[model samples]
Target chain A: MIDYRGLQALAMVIEHGGFERAARHLFITQSAVSQRVKHLEALIGQPVLMRTTPPKATAMGQRLHSHWQQVRLLEAGLGIASTPNQLTVRLTVNADSLATWLPEALVLPDHPNVSFDLLVEDQAVGLRRMRQGEVMACLCASAEPVNGGRVAFLGYLRYRAVASPEFIANYGLKDLSRLPDAPCLVFNRDDPLQHEFLATVVGGTPQRIHYCPSSEGFVEATRVGLGYGMIPELQFRDLLASGELVDVVPGYALSTPLYWHYWQTESDVMLNLRTQVIKIAKQRLLAEA
Target chain B: MIDYRGLQALAMVIEHGGFERAARHLFITQSAVSQRVKHLEALIGQPVLMRTTPPKATAMGQRLHSHWQQVRLLEAGLGIASTPNQLTVRLTVNADSLATWLPEALVLPDHPNVSFDLLVEDQAVGLRRMRQGEVMACLCASAEPVNGGRVAFLGYLRYRAVASPEFIANYGLKDLSRLPDAPCLVFNRDDPLQHEFLATVVGGTPQRIHYCPSSEGFVEATRVGLGYGMIPELQFRDLLASGELVDVVPGYALSTPLYWHYWQTESDVMLNLRTQVIKIAKQRLLAEA
Candidate 1:
C-alpha cells in the first residue's frame, strides 16, 4: 500500500507550488518531501510530477491528488481526523447566487470544524474549475455535470431589464425602438445577458455600455443612472416594488436555469451541503419544471 | 502612409478571434479581411499576427493594436467618429471600492457617449490586465504604476476583524489567543489579509477557514455566522454602529492603501475618470500618507 504521508506530500507540493514551500507548510525538511515524492514515483513505476520550476502535477499525480482528497474527506466524515476534526471543502460559485440566496444555505449547523474555500466564477464556465481539480464542486448555470460528478437543477433565475426613473426620463426610454441609442450596463464582456435580453426584445444592440462586475454594485450603478441593463429578479424585485428600478421592457423577462454540480462523495459535510442547497434554492429561485 | 482601414481590420481580427467573425462584424468578405491583414504585414515588413488557430497578436501586432486604440480615443476626444459620437473605455477595478463608492464616480455627465467596460480583479494583480493591453486603467492597492502609466494615491481602505454576536458567543471568541480555533473567512486563497491580521494579533493560523470572494457576500456570510472575517470599514462602519457586527479585535485595524493607475492619455473620458475617482476615493478612504 502507498503511504498516505506520500500522498499528503504530493498534495501539499501542488497546493503550495513548490517543494520548499510544501516542506515549510508540512513542518518537514525539503529533502524529505522530495524523497517521499520520489518514493511515490517508484511505487507507481511512472513519473507523477513534472520536474519544472515550481513543479506541476502529471496526470498520474493529479489522479493521486484527487484520491488523497477523497480519502481525507471520508476520514473526516467518519471522525478519523488526525488534526482533531478539521476539514476544508473548496468550491466555485457565481456572483448572482452569492449575492442572493446562497448564504442562507451556507449557514450550516454548529459543526464549525468543517470549513469552506470558495472562489467566485461566472456560472457559464464554473464547471471548468471542477474538471481542473481546483475545486470539488461548482454552482453554475449549466446543468451538465463533470466526470464522476452529479448535477441538480436549482430552478431559474429571472432577469428583467431595468433603469431608474431619472434615467428613463433623461434618455427618453419610453420609445421602445430607440432603446438601442441609450446607455446600458453589462457585468463584463463575457457576460451575454444584456445581448440576450436585447435579442429577445429590441433586436438592436445599445450604442453606449458600462460594465460593473459586482452583483450589488451592478444594482447601485443602475440606481445612480450609469446605464440600464438586466438585473436578477432576486436582487431587483424589492427595488422594482419600491419604484427604485423600473423595467425598461415591461411584461418581458429573461430566465436562466441554474445548476449545482458536485463530485459524488460519501462525506457528511458535502451531503449536508447538497441537501441544504437543493432545498433552499428550490424555495428561493423561480419554481420551474 | 499605411492604410487605416487595414489597421482596423487587423484590430477586428484580433478582437473577434478569427477572420470569419471579423469579416461578419466588419460587413466585409473573409478573404477581404485576410487580405487587409496581409496588407498590414507587408507594410510592417514582417508578420504582425501569428497564423495560429485563434490568430494571436505578435509583439508588433499588439503595439499596433494599442496604437489603434489610442488613436481611436484621440479621435473620439476630437470628434472624428464615422458613427457620430460613441466611445467605450475598458478597465479593471477591485470589488471593495465598487461596492462602496466607485459607481457615483462612474456616473459621468450627459455625454452618455462615453461608455465603460469594467472587469473585477483583485487589487494586487489588476495592473496585469492593463499591462496585457486588455484595459486602459486599473484601480488597485499598489502605488507602483505600470510602464508609461501614472498612479495617484487614493488613501487607505481600513479593515477590522468582525463577527456576529451569536458566533462570538458560540465559539467563545473573547480570548485573543484562541482566535485561530474558530472558523475564519477569507476572500480567496490568494488573499493574505486574514494571515496578516492573525500574524499581528495571535501569530497562529486558523484550522477552520471559509473563503467567500464577494465583497458584499463576504459581509453577509459573516453576518449570518458562516465565520468571522475582516470587513472593510466602508462596508462595515454602519453595521458596527448599528450593533449588527462586533469587532473581534478592538483598537487595531489593517489598512490597505489604494491607488489609481491609468495609461498616460489626453482622452477626456479617461482623464475625467481619473479625476473623479481620485476626488471621491480620497473623501471615502482613510486619510493616509
Candidate 2:
C-alpha cells in the first residue's frame, strides 16, 4: 500500500512547483519531504517527476496527482468536522458570468466552510480546464458534460448590439449597409457574438475593429464610441434605459446558452454549491429551454 | 481569378469576428463587405468561416487568413508613406520580461510607428500563440524557432529563493531540511523555479504551498512573510540589498533562458524591432551560451 503522506508530498510538489516549497507548506524538513517522494518513487519503481526547470509530473505522476486530488476532496467532504478550514474549491468560469451573476451566487446562504480559487477564461475554453483536471467544476458554454461530471443548464445570456447616441449620429448608421465603415468593438479575437450578429444582418466582417478584452472595458469602449459592440443585457440595462446607449440595429440580438458542470461527487458541499449557482443564474439570466 | 478585395473582406471578418464589424473596419458598406466575401466564396467554391458563435476559420479559411496577413504586412512595409497610423503589432510574452526589460526596448531611438498588443502568458505557453497565428512574435523559453520565425537568444533570467528576515526567524529555516513545512509562495501553477531549487537542495515536493498568480502580488506576499519564493534577481535585488529579504538557499539559484521569436519578414520595421529587443535583453539578463 502507498503511504498517504508520500502521496500528499507528491501532490504538494506539483502544487507548489518544488520540494523545498512543498516542505514549507507541510511544515516538515525538506529532507523528509524528499525522502517521502523518493520512497514513493521507489515503491512505484518509476520516476514521477520530469525534473525540468520547473518540475512537471510524468504521465503516471499526473494520473497519481489527479487521484490524490479526488481522494483529498472526498476525504475533506467526509471529514468536514475534523478540518473546518481545509476546504479549497477550485473552479473555472467565463468573464461575462463572473462580471454578471457569479459573485452573487457565491455569497448565497449555507455556503460551506470553503474558499474558492477561480480560473477565469472564455466559457467555450473554460470546460477544457475541467477536462485537464485543473478544476473541480466549470461554468461553460456547452450542455455536454465531460467524463464523470454532471451538467446542468443555466439559462441564456442575452446580448444587444449597442452603440452610444453620439456614435450613431456621427456614423449615420441608419441601415446595415453603413455598418462596414464604422469601427466596431470586440471583446477579443475569440469572441463571436458580434460576428454572429453581423453575419445575420450584414453577412460580412467589419472594416475597422478595436479589440478590448475586459468586460467592463468592453462596455466603456462601446459607451465612449470607440466602437459599437454586443453588450450583455445585465451589464448594459442601465445605460440602455438612460439612452446613453442604443441598439444600432433595432430588433436584433444574440443569446448564448450556458451550463454548469461539476465532477460527480456525493459531497454535500459540492451539491449545495451547484444548486446555489443554478438558482442565482436562473434569476439573473434569460430563461430558455 | 480571386479578387484581392474579397480576400481582404474574408480576412477582416476572421480578424474582427463578424461581418458588420469587418465592414466597419474596411470603411465600406456592409453589403459591399458581404458581396466581397460571397464573391470570394463563390470563386473558391467553399465556405471559409464556420459560422459558430465566435466565428472560426475553416482550414482553408485559416490558410487564406495567414496568407492575407503576410501580404498586409508586406504591403505595409512597402507603403509606409500611404498610411502612417496603421501599424499595429501583436506579440506574446512572459510576465517577468514585461516587468523587467521589455518596456525599455520599446522606446529605443528611431522606434517604428507601431502600437503593440501584448498577450502575457508563461514562456512555454506563449510560443503556442505564435504557432496558432494569434500573434506575429513571441518571447518564449525555448530556443527552438517556430516554422518560419527567426530565433535569437536572449540571456538567462536568474532567480533566487528568498525569504524575509522575519520569516527566517519564525521558521528557523537555516538548513534545506526545514524547507518542506514552511509555507512557500508560487507565482502560478506553471512556475517551477522554486521547485527546481528545492529539488536540488532537499530533493522533494513542498508539503505546504500558497499560490499567488500576479508577479507584483507574489513579491508582496513574500515581503509580508506569507511564504518564501523564487524571485527574479532583477526584481528582488533592491529588497535584498535593504535587508528586507535574504536568500534562503545561498550560493544556489535558477536561471531560465529566454528567446525572441518573430516571423521572418523583409520589413525594416520587423528587423529593427528584433535588434532593439536583443540588445536590451543582453544588457538586462545574465549572459550565457
DockQ scores for all predicted structures: 0.64, 0.06
Tens digits of per-residue lDDT, candidate 1, A1-289, equal 7777888889888766689978977889999999999988998999889988669999889888867776777776666547564555777888888888888788778455776767788764577768876677799888778888889888888888999999999888898777887887887656788888777777986566677889888988888888898888888777888998998988878888888898776577788888898999989898863
Compose the digit string of candidate 1's lDDT tens values, residues B1-289: 7678889898878766689978977889999999999998998898889988779989889878767776777776675557354555677888878887788788778455776767778765588767777677888888888888889888898888998989898888888888888888887756788889898898987666777888888888888888889878878877888888999988878998888888876587788778888888877888862
User: DockQ (C-alpha) of model 1?
Assistant: 0.64
Highest lDDT: give the candidate number.
Answer: 1
Taking all chains together, each candidate's TM-score versus the true structure is 0.88, 0.57
lDDT of 2 at B228: 86
What CAPRI grade goes to candidate 2? incorrect
Off by over 4 Å in 1: A1-3, A16-21, A34-63, A81-85, A131-134, B1-3, B13-21, B38-63, B81-85, B131-134
| Model 1 chain A worst lDDT window (10 residues) | A79-88
Runs in model 2 deviating more than 4 A are: A80-85, A108-113, A122-125, A131-134, A207-211, A241-244, B1-74, B77-88, B91-289
lDDT of 1: 0.81
Pairs of colliding residues, candidate 1: none
